[model samples]
Each structure stands twice: as structure tokens, then as C-alpha cells.
Target chain A: MNESSLPFFARGMDPGPSFVDVLRRLAPHGVAGSGAPDHGSALIDTVHGTTVVAIRFASGVIMAGDRRATSGMSIASRRIEKVFAADDFSGIGIAGAAGPAVELVKLFQVQLEHYEKIEGEGLSLDGKANQLGGMVRANLPAAMQGLVVVPLFAGYDERRGIGRVFSYDVTGGKYEEADFQTNGSGGVHARNWIKATWRDDMTRDEAIDLALRSLFAAADEDAATGGPDLVRRIFPTVAVIDTDGFTSVSDDEIATRAEALLGGREEGAGL
Target chain B: MTMPFYVSPEQVMKDRADYARKGIARGRSLVAISATDGIVIVAENPSRTLYKISEIYDRIAFAGVGKYNEFEMLRIAGVRQADVKGYSFAREDVNARALANAYAQTLGQIFTHEMKPYEVEILVAQLGETPDDDELFHILYDGTVMDEEGFTVLGGLSEQVHESLGATYKPPIDRATAVRLGAAALTPADQAPLNAGALEVAYLDRARARRAFQRLKGPELDAVLAG
Candidate 1:
């Protein structure tokens, strides 16, 4: 029964699909799948992130990302989707490469579901964050090629019955943010907004508004961050990760929030 | 070669087939059908966990009866193949025919090469985007495959179940009707009818997303059977 002697496949057998196997199978050739090349990948790529912020409210966690995606001095996309569903119980906000970052989120999502199905049990919140760290570390070679992906993962832990957040670097340095944290180009501006408005016991409404204001402030200062578009009807993606699951704030509600924010309401309200 | 009496190949094949059929006949039968809502699988198993019908992939489902361990292995293989193919190519490309063919090959190989043939009959059901394309591919113990359009049955007492299901089965039936049809097929009319608790049921819902696989349990299953 000892781990040292069992063959790889036999030891790894579970009801759900294997996440590592999927990663290995999906990685590009020898680049991201296995071996030492990916071993230190999280460190190799030094893609500087702008901002990512997470806030804890009465219900769960509120996560918001800017609409802009930047590469070097150029704005890659004005409406690049940065927030993604990690699972029903979680959501992830990425601030690195427009490509690999998104791919990493998708893989994370599949890994969770696959694990849930095969093992008949969901991985712990900490386990999921670590899995992301491993994936980041695995992408070292590609990260060196200017394809770095740094992501902020936030989710509601069903077992703990509370929302949790984790931030990662290109080299897979994972840190659990206790109160709040932000990453990316406009992260400084965004984080300041949260730091000022975030309260000790903010309700879900206050947290959401706080999250929106932070993103608005980020968009106001950084050209790389796109503010809410009244014409195209696009807004920064927002989601709530709570005890229930991850639910994206509907576009209609986002539009309303944007309208209210722009309608003479002072930008900085709460301390 | 042993200097002993040689048995004919025909005898060998016959013995293997009988062994497989007899083993298969000892278990319960399951019915797979393309319903209006989606594809339904009804297995006559008392134990809920030891399911004869299970998900192979997002769009594909597997149902088998006979030796539990043997069919369970095949179920895992089907899952691996489907997952591998889907990951490599597009999800839509993982069709019923491809899975059925793979099962046929493996089952055929085992039937001939191994001393014992797998005493199992399995079904590969896929709910296509359209009703016309929804297919139920049944694979028997001896590597025989049947491309069923509307409905089909497999495992022990198949002759009786299939005959019963065939009479009431209609193309593009609704979800509840399909469930009732499946239960009827597996139940002995001469005895008491099976209630929802006695039957194991799941469906490949067409109305859902890419992955149609879903289990019908608890009150929802009760409602369906009641209807």
C-alpha cells in the first residue's frame, strides 16, 4: 500500500478523469506538458500583470476584471474577456497573456469537473489553487517566449462554506490573499479603490459596487483598461463566488451599475 | 501441439458463444431509446451505485449487463477512448458509430483470442443535434452490432424485453413515455410492475448543452415514472 512501489497508473486510478494526464496530453509537444522545462516555468516567464482585485462580502466573494488586454505598448483587445468560470462553485480572473491565460482557465475548469466526476469528490480550495500553480509552473518554456499567463483564482469553498481567493505569479508563486488582492497593468489603480471602499463587514451589494468602482478607476487612469462602453453596451465582467456556486452578473445588471456610477455619484465614497 | 484429440473450431466457437450468452442471461436487461426530449437508458438493477448504464463521454453513454467487472472495464476503456478522441479532435466527432466500432473490435478480439468470451451486452447511445441522427448502437457478447434507430434492448431476457418494447415504441416519443416503455420492457407483465425505486434510470437530454448525460433520481425520476 506504500506509495514508493506502486506503478503510476494503478496508484492514480480514480472515478473522475486525471487532470495531470489531460494537461500532459493537451500541452504543445515538449513545451508545457511534462519534465523540467515546465518544472520552473512559473518563474521563467516574467509577464508583468496589471491588476486583479477580490473582495469578501456577506454572501461570498466578488471578482472583477478590466475589459482591456495589453501586450507590450499595444492594446491587444478592448473587450478581451478576462473573467472565466472555474466551475459552478468558482471563477477565475486572468491578467497575463490573452492566449495562454485563457487556455489555463479553461484547463482549470475541465480539471475540476473531471476530478469531481471521477473521484466523486471535489478537490479542496487550496488543492485547486495549487493545481493552477503547477500548471503555471509547467508553462515555463512558453512563458519565456512572451506567452506568460498570470491568473487570480477565486472560488467558494463548499466544505468551508466561505469564499476564498488565490493569486499567482508567472513562476507559479501562489499566495492566498486574506482581505483582497489585485494584479495586471491597471491593478494598482483598481486595488487602491478597493482598499479605500472595502469595509470590515461589507454586504454583497457594497462589495459588488466596490468591485465596479475599482475597475472604473482603473479604466479611468490606464489606457490599457477599457471603461464601460455605453455605445457598444460592454462592461467589465463581474461574478459572485459564494457557497452556492459561481454566477456571472448579468449584462443587464452591469449596464445598470455602469449607468448609476456615471450618473453624478462621487467616485470615492467609503473609507 | 498436444498429441491428443483435437476439438473442431466450430465446437470451440459454439462453446464460447454459449458460455457468453448464458452468463449474460443471468443478469438484467436495459433498454436504450431516442426520445423526444433526448435519449433514455433504463436498467433493471436494484442497486443504484452498481449501475449498468453509465456515461462514456459528454454526448455518449454506455450500458451493459453480464459480468459486472468485465463490462465495467469496457466502460472505462470507452471513457478513455472518447476522452482521448474528444481532446485531440472536436467533441462532435466522438459519435456513436465510432465508439460502437471500437467496442465491436475489442469484443470480437476478446471472443476469439481469450479462452472466455465476455458475458456482456452493451449499448452506446448518442443524442445527436437532431432527432433523426439520435442513434442507439447495441453490441452483443459475440461482437454482433445492431444499429437501432428508435429503441433497443440488451442483456438477460432480451427477447421478451425487446418484443415488449418494440410493440409500444414510437419514433420521437417524449421523455416520460420513453421511461415507461423501458420499464415495461424490463418488467414481467405476468407479475407486479416495477416502481421507480426498483428501476435505475438516466437520460441524455437533448435540450441541454454539449454534454447531454444526466441521471434521473429522487423526486424527478419519481415524477417521470409516474407520468
Candidate 2:
């Protein structure tokens, strides 16, 4: 709160438009650091679970994540949110260690806003993806301690006039996926499901259905992932980013889609 | 070593104030007015890249005149302060009042203690949910703070601009009218009206979500001026 009280000379040596750098210089511990001891031995004891998928379509991109966080054989949280708005035109979905993943998302959000505020313009989509890569790289220390966080970043690239998807490794290696990407415990299942159904030039409805079906398939096979809970009305979080901006799908719509999918599965079993 | 001749405290302060004032007077003027929906800032700046008005937070905006380097430093400091505060606390808690006070403290300290005072005049404007809550804090070169309602002008020829603005300014003005009024005030009586390209305009619209600060430029600026 009293950040302005820093000496005039120090203020003059501003870290030049990077909020993360400024935080690192002023509050070193706040930015991801390497001091924490490794928890690799008991990694399963900590909260870990996810199935987040991002698919690029004709208009833009669709990002969806199931609401589940588990520790070992126990469910830690049932309605945990994993998808967040990176900015107006971008979205991020996290999977891996819940605590560190959420922290990384918060930091990424701040970094983008900070850059925009200081530079008087938002960074290009490429610049934003690269920035996230740097943050993930910095979090390498935490990742080595079994607190790995892999996030899926998707956004409507205004300059390129299309939606783009970028996935990352534990050490901040960024890979631009041509079609779709998935992360978390059930990522493999979700990825296979998406590969079978995904098609270029798909409409928004088809893309949404594909995202929901992939998440459903992941939840069906992966014990850590949670499926839609009809009694509790908990559905996967889905966000659509396109030319207009980023908008999250409503829970009612998701429920409707989940019900239809369930009905089709029942009929197929009977047949 | 001979003893240095002692200058009176009042004389030293006066000299510093005069020096600061002269540096400020060499620059063009800027204005901020409370509009029907939010706050609008207009500056007679020809450079498209060098901004004189900018956003400091979601609801707060900053405008500076006098020295570009000095004011830009202040602008960046304000942004840092706001961002840090919002990060530490809630975003709603980052208001203009605290930022203006911080600027005053720094400018005042430098004016009296530093070898050379900073030559800058800055305004911190926060758009409230309602027109009655809008605030315009004008901080002068010597760290003098003025909490003005309705409108305020800063920099060289401020008195003339103030008079022109006061004569035409009315509460609850629309965005286009506010821009025209500010443009008229910044223009000298003998000179023709300024075109959109020569002016820098920004607004903190209350209706805007989260971040309210937006620049009006190119065709948007031309359209507003034409309107």
C-alpha cells in the first residue's frame, strides 16, 4: 500500500514496464523463487487433478476445464475453478498442482495488466504467450519440487485475425498447437477424444460440443477428473474467445449439453 | 575558508518556486472536465506517441503538463503505486485521493530538500459511479493540491484557458461537447480551432467495465471533433 514511499532514486531506476521484474526487485519472495524444499516424495499428498482442453475453430478458440481437485485418493475440492481470463481477448486454463497453478495464473494476469498500463498498449498475442513462457520458466524451481503447473493459453490474435493456442512444459517450453491441446491428469484421454472429433472450419456449436465431449471422456476414464454433477449442478467451465472478446458459457447451457450427451450414451448402450 | 553569504529562507523558497513556475510556463496547457458519464482529459499535444494523459487505475486517470520527462516519471510512479496497492488490497481501494497525496508529498519534499525541484503540474481524476462523486485533484509544481469540481486547467496560459472554459463549461456535458469546450479553451483567440490530429484526448467513462480509460484517436478523434 505504501509502495510510493520507496526513495526517489530507487523509483527512478524503474524495472522498465515489467511488473514481474518490478515485483522481483522490490518483493523478491512474491515472484516465484527456489527457496521451498522439494516435496517430490509426497507429491501425491498435495492437491492435483485436471482435464483442461483448448480447441481452435473457424471463428476463434474454445477453452474448457472440469471442476475437480484431488489429493491422493481423496477429493480436495469439487467446484474448483481452473479457467481464468488472461485479458479481454485471452484465456488461461491450468492443470497440475492446484496451489502453484492458481498462483501462476494470478501472476500472469498481473503481468499482462502491468505491461499494458506502463507501455500504454497491450502486448501482441505473441508477446503475451512469450511472457507466460518466461513465467513458467521462472517457476521451474517450484516445478522441480513436484509443484509443476502446466497452463493452456488461448487467445484471439487481433493482428493475425485468428485464434491461437499455446501449450507449455514444466520448464516453460512453449509449443504452438495447430489444432488442439490438453493438460492435467486426464489430459491424454481428453486429447484422444478431441483428436477423433475435431475438424477445421467447425461452427461454434460443434466446437463447444467437442470440448464438452472431450472433458466428459476424460472424466469417464480418469478417476481424478470429475464429471458433471446433475444433483449439484456443477458443470465444466467453458470460455469462448473470438473477435468480439472472451465470454464464458453459462452453466444452464452446459447442463443441457451434458444431458443430451448422457441420453445419447444411454441409447448407444441399449443398442 | 570564508563564510558563505546567507540567503533568507523566504528568498530561497521564492527562487525555487519561480524556477519551477518558469519551467512549467514553457509548455502547452491541458484540461480535465467532468462529463455526463465520466471524466474527459484534453491536451494540446502534437506527438502521437508522447502521451500527456493516461490511465493510472481502473477508475483513475492522470494528466500532466510542463515537462514531459518529469511528468512521465510521475505518471509511471502513479501507475506503480496504484497497481501495487490494488494487488496488496482490493482493486476498489485504489482511489485517486491517496495517489494525489503521495504525489504531493514527493513533490513537496523535493521542492524543499532536493538540489533542484521537479518542474511539473499533474492532475489525478477519478470517475465515480455517479456524477456527484467525480473528483479532480490538481497538483502544482510546488506540490500545492487543489480539489476542483466540474473542471480544471494546467500549464502556461492557464488563466486564459480557465476563463474560456469557465465561460462555456456547464455540468453534465456530453463527451463530444466536453472535447469541443476543452479544445476551444486551449486554442488562443487569434488562432484557428485545433484539429483532431493536434490534440490528445482520453476518457474515463463510468459505463466502461473494469478499466475505464480509453484514448480517442484517428477516425474516432475526428468523429468526436466533427460531432
Candidate 3:
């Protein structure tokens, strides 16, 4: 953003491969918390996205998120996408303050790419998670102003040849989730559903179905979490990160799955 | 005190320019050709770990042919500039012209003010929606920037390679043909032919989503050349 000069730093003073570090050196107050709202005074009812979940299957990881952003008791939006591909092999799911959450995802994506280009190789899975952690830590000032952002990170680790998921706290503490992880207002309900149905050797289709079902269950319990809106044909956004790469499940397919899921529930309720 | 001899500014500049040119002339050459899909870049480099071409942004790519360290520094700076700009504004806002101008300013400043000029000749290529919109910028060590059409060459053998490439290149070429042409042009007349392993190839594919730059190596490189 600084006018047209190449960002060449002196020896030992370089930001290395970190894009955030470069931002700090060039413009100390450029990124997060720049113009954050004051902490007190009945914090603004900014839009808040909710309920994103990640489940690890045999081959890789599948992340799914409901399409809802609630401002106080009102639905601010019905098609807010929470799940995003962090890179070719990884994905991110966001929750909390909608504005800052989306911004964090954008910044995080740039961070991964920036490091990859500068270092001539991508960061290790663990390293990517830690990098996101540091970014979350940087957002602490903004988080305190009632714009807390908690994100779930999942990726297919090339070295380990398995899917990995990481969850973070507001304080930037990162924890690896072995089987699965869920976050946001409906996180508990979704996690409960996943814990009941998830298995070690589930196929890709099974994993995707389980992810959709978990979001459905969360939506049933949490008002902020949106269920499949058949009238609008809006379904939860889903993405799978595998050895091949990150691929999003198409909306048409998700719509069919949502319809089938509801039909099965209807039959069970009748029974 | 002993009298100190003074050197004229013009002579000093000429000396610096010559030194930089000599340093650049010792390195291998690189070529970028515009094709239907994107711009293909081929460099005659044997070192697997070191890269002469790399992605700068979603659509922009940076390539340098000269002293590896000096060019590498320039490459990293270009990445930083493009990334920072994309972060601040929209990705589409970052363009080759702006990046080329920035590089020119930096090199010019160093050449005019510093004790020594950087021994690097760089290329910043941006893939356009159509073949005609594609842009190639060739920048010199002394901060001169040339907006090239169709194809551009960099490094010590640029004049010869450029001429050879111009003879064979045709517009709207496909990826495979572009790679072959670039490779053919990079090989000097007196030297033995370069194999796949001895060359580093990459392209900025407009058809690709998001980051468009991709490297051609190993089996892929072999396949393209063989084709």
C-alpha cells in the first residue's frame, strides 16, 4: 500500500517471509484494530456469522458452515459463506464479528500465499496453523472491542499424508483437533452430532453427508445458524481438503443433499 | 595531505554501468512468450532449488536473469510490493505497469546514487484476458524499462535469443508450442542443446483461477518439450 517502491529491507531488518511483518514495518497501524469501535457503550450490533464445523475422514478433511449472519435478533444475511480455502491444500472456517472475520480470512489467505512465494515453498501444516495463531493474536486488540474472531483451520498435511484440523481461542491459543472440531453459536450441538455419527473409515461421500447433517442439527438448535432454505435453495457451504487439493461441493449437489436429508428426517418423524 | 584524484561523474556512471553489464552477461538467459492460454517463461537454469521465475500476484509474474543474489532480492521485493498492494486494495488493482515502474524507480535510484548498481535484468509479465492484452516488461540494471510486444528476452544473450525467437514465433500459440519456442530460443548456437532438467519453465495461465503462475518441471516439463 505504500506508494510504488519495492519493499527491500536492510540485512537482519527484513520481515523474512511474513506479510504481516512487512505491513507492520511499513505502516505500523495498517492492519487489524486500526479503527475499531470503542469497547464499552453497548457494543454495536454488527453482523455476526455462526456455526462452522470440520470433520476428519479417512482420506482428508471436510469443512462446512451455515449461511447466516445475525445482528442482535435480526437476520442480517442468509448467504454469508464461512468456509474458505486457505490455499490449495487447506481450508478455513470463520465465526464471530462478520466484518473482522471476513477480513481475517482475507488477510490469512494473503499471509499463506505471501510466505509461499517469498520462501519458494509453502509453510508446513503446523507452521501454517501457527501463522494463523499469530494473526489471531494480533487481532486481540480488536477482539477486546467486541469483535472476537475464532476460526477453525483444516488442511491435508503433505508430510503426514493425513488431514489436520486446528481450533483457536480468542487469546490465540491453538489446539489440534484429532477427530473433528466445531465452532460458533451452534458449535456444541454440531459437535455433539458429529461425535455421535463420525467414524474412522468414512468415505468422502459419508464425510460430506455427516458434515451437512451436523450443520442441519446445529441449525435445528441454534437460531443464528441457518438451515437449508428449500424455498431459496440455499444450503450450507461445504469444502473438502484432500491429497488432491481443496474442492468446494457445488450448490446444486448441496441442494439435493439438503432435500434428501430433510426427506429422511420427515420419514423418521412420521415413524 | 596527499592530493586525491577526482573522477568525473559521467565516467563513474559509465564504469558502474559496464560493471553491472558484465556481471549480468555472465548469467544464463530467460525468454517469455505470449500464447493463447498465457505467457510462458523459459530459463536455462540447472539449479533445482534456485528459481529464475516465480509468481508475483494472481496474474502477475516476476523473472530475473543475472547475478542470482541480486535478481533474487529484486524478485522478493516485487512479491512484497504486489502482495502488499493486493492486501491494501483489490487484487485487480495491482498491475504490471505499476510494478514495473516501482522496479524501475528502485533500480534507477540505486544506479544513480549507490556506489554500485545491481547486476539484474528482470521481467514482469501480466496475463490478460486475451492474448493481445498480455504485457511483458523488461527492466535493466540502470532502471530502464521496455514494454515488449508478443515476446521478450532477458539476460546476456537477449539480442541473439530475441532475434532467433522472433523468427519462429506466431501469435495465439498454444502452451506446448510456446514452451518449445521459448526453449529453442534460449539455447545458444554454439552450445549443446539443453535438456528438460537443465531448464526452468513457468507460465502465467489466464485460464487458471486466482494465482495464475505455475512452474513446469520434471515429467511435465519433459512432456511439453517432447510434445
Candidate 4:
């Protein structure tokens, strides 16, 4: 398609601020929920991602997701990324149907950038969360057809001078989590681990460790969630979003942490 | 039934062009200069909130001088177009030439067919990897597109401003020098020097990542102008 030209109107009827609204008006199908058709048959064989966790700490928020995609009883992909930067200061971790989940993240990223450029300012953290909720609501039709996409959004709230986390239901209901949130096939195990280890005033390092431990526990019990692969050098994606903005933790750091976790487990087994 | 008066097509075209030019000429002028770092645009806009320079895409920027509502409408349209195109194809595909052509088409169509032509002149600038690759397209109210080099000016008294810019136009200048030159050219002969507060500055610095457009205001603008 050609580049979009300026949209014209008589006067005062402009599609103000929202890029999604503009897309909805210009190309209805381009908007996420407006195009996906509902199917009768279940999409049971689709690639589904497991285990993603977000923890709010003293400085900001830590988002981590295991690098695995599963279809029914078999592994579909082992190095699938599930954590994405929604904007400079915000990120989203996906934990549901892999295809739709990735698409949702991409669309959300574009939506945020689009709004910022059009309005000449970034949206508030709350506004962004609500916007994600709206996108999820729009995906309800596909969600009903078993192509659900559930995401956890975390951002550093400039107004409040603190990090905030929001989790969404399949129907697009948003709930602001107080400390930490987790989702996916291994969500139960990961959530339990976080509940026992989470703290209100954890440091950045402690938050990262807790997230890694939670994912490790999830992978241990759930077949869909893959643990850190030493041979393949594949590790979970971990990102920190704070006042300085979103930055992905290096693979070496993650590997070192995973190795330490495994060494501790080995010591426990010996005992 | 009374017959409508026969107006010659030349007369009608001239009238529309004249009307559009008058509307545009009422606004203050702006200029875009290709610099060593990237492209620098300086406009004589005092209002901080109402911008005349904005990003259109990753490497493309849009600048306009004319009716506020009219140019702003064009700006939003350009944003929508670039975003949608980038979304559909790859990001690199959304360039200034394509956007310039699109603007020309829209403006030209409106100028010829509509009862009231849009009173706006716009610039679509794309900063390339090197100084040689930078593109500057100056589009007119009647959809005339000029692929400019070194520097281009827009809005009222553009001829005088263009001459001023042409006299001092030099390639591969630094950011500060480009801003100073543009500010000098924008200032009228009889008027005092335009201060930082009276100017709006933005640039597509190649050193910047993906989105290259940036605004220089307040102290930063002052620093650049002082240099």
C-alpha cells in the first residue's frame, strides 16, 4: 500500500488523537478485532505460549517470559520471544495463543507511537492500559474461537513516580495488580512461586531473581513452559522498565542467574 | 431559468492560485536546510504548542505554512499515511518521495476540483544515511512539487527569504551553523535579529535512532542560536 496522505474534512471533524480510531475509520480491517472472523471449530493445534510474569519493585517494573511455544502435547518452538517493548517506558508480556499474542503486542506498540506522534505527547500510563484493554475486548470474537491473547502490561508511571502493572482477562477486563502478576499454561505454578517470594520493596536485582525463580518453577511443573536451556544458550527474555525507559537484560546476566538457580537446586537434591 | 456567467478556465485557475497564495503569504516563513548532522528546519512560530514542524515517519518530517487548521489537517493525514504504509510494508519503504507525491496529488486535486483550494505550502524532508542522500521536497498549494537541495523556504515573503537563504547556502554545515543561517535568512532586513524564543527549531539528526525528528526549544534553542 502507498503511504497514508493527510485525511481531509470540511472542518472540526478530524479523527482526534487516537491512531486506532483513525485506522478504524480509514481501514476497518487494519484494526485488530475488526477483521478476525469467528470460526466454529476449535484451534486446538495452534501454537500457545506459556509463562510470563511481571513484578513491581522499588525502582520500576520487571517483565519476564519463558522462550517456549507449545501446540497440544508437543513443543512448537523453543526460542519464541514473548516479551516486547510497547513503548520506550512500557512493555507487554504475552502468555496465550502465540500468533494472536505477538500480533497484539505489535499493534499495541504501533498504537502507542502513533498516538504520540499525532497528539505531540505520549499517553498516560492509565490511558495506555485502557487502550490495551480495548484491543483485547475487540479480540473477543477470536478469543471465543479459542484464539485468546492475554497480555500483562507494565510501565513506569511518570505521574505517580512509581511502576504499575495491569493484567487482562480474555474479554478485555483490566485489573491493576498491586505487586506482581503472571499468566499462561504455567501461570498457576508461577503465581504461587511469586506469592511466596514477592516483596513490596524489592530491589532491581531481587526483582529479576524472583521473576527468574517463578519462571523456573513454572517450567519445572508445566510441560508448555521451557526452562533455561544451557546447551542451546536460550534463556527467558527479561526487561526492566524504569525512569530511564525499557531495557532488556543481557543474555549473559540471565544465564548466570539461571546457572546459580540450577546450582542451588543441585545442592538441594544432594541434601 | 437564468444562464450562469461564463468564466474562462484561465481566470478561474488564476483566481484559485491567487487566493491560495494570499492565504499562505499571510503566515511567517520557515526554512529547511540540509546539514552535516541531518536536516534542520527553522520556523518563525512563537507558539510552543502549535507546531509547524513534525515527524511524518522514521526518517521523514513534515513542515507547513498556511492556515493552521488546513496545514494541521494535512499533517495528520501524512502521519496516518506513513504509519499505515509502514505497518503494511516494511518501515524503510515509507520515504519522503512517496509521501511528497501523495501530498502533491491530494493538494493538486483539491486545488483544481474544490470550490475553495487549501491555503497551504508544505515540505516533506527525508534524511538519508549520508548528506548526499538527504531529500527535500517543497510542495505548493496547487500541488507543485520542487525537489530542493541545500535549502528551501516556505510561506509569506518566501521569495525574499529564498534569496537570503540562497546567498548563504552552504553544504555539510554543522547543526549550529545551519540553525544560525536559517534564522538569519528568516529575519527581515529591517527587523532585529530573531531570538531563540521567537523561533521554532527541529531537525532530523542522522545520529539519532529510527525516529530522527527532534525539537530544539527554550535553553537548547538558545544555545544553538548563540553558537
Identify the leading candidate in terms of lDDT. 3
Q: For residues B169-222, could you state the per-residue lDDT of candidate 1 as single tens digits?
A: 867688888998898788987987788788999999988876678888878888
* Tens-place lDDT digits, model 2, residues A1-271: 3544622326467688888777665666667644557554434578975889999999999999999999878999999998899999999999988888887888888889989988989999999999999989988877787878889999999998899999999889999999899999899999998998789999888898889888888888899999878799888999999998899998888889877877887743411
Model 2 misplaced regions, further than 4 Å: A1-13, A38-44, A267-271, B1-3
Q: Name the best candidate (by DockQ).
A: 3
**lDDT: worst 10-residue window of model 3 chain B:** B186-195
lDDT of 1 by residue, A175-211 (tens): 9988787878788888887887778788777887788
Per-residue lDDT of A11 in model 1 = 38
DockQ of 3: 0.79
> Can you write out model 3's per-residue Cα lDDT over A75-161, one digit (the tens) per residue?
999999999999999999999998888888998899999999999999999999998898888888888878899999999999999
Q: Locate the minimum summed-lDDT window of 10 residues in model 2 chain A.
A: A1-10
What interface RMSD does candidate 3 have? 1.2
Candidate 2 backbone collisions, by pair: none
- Best TM-score among the predictions, by candidate number: 3
Please report how far candidate 4 places residue A29 from its true position, in Å.
3.4
| Candidate 3 residue pairs in clash (backbone atoms < 3 Å) | none
Better of 3 and 4 by TM-score: 3
Ranking by TM-score: 3, 4, 2, 1
Candidate 2: lDDT of A92? 96
Interface RMSD of 1: 9.4
Local distance difference test scores for all models: 0.77, 0.88, 0.90, 0.89
The 10-residue segment of model 1 chain A with minimum total lDDT is A1-10
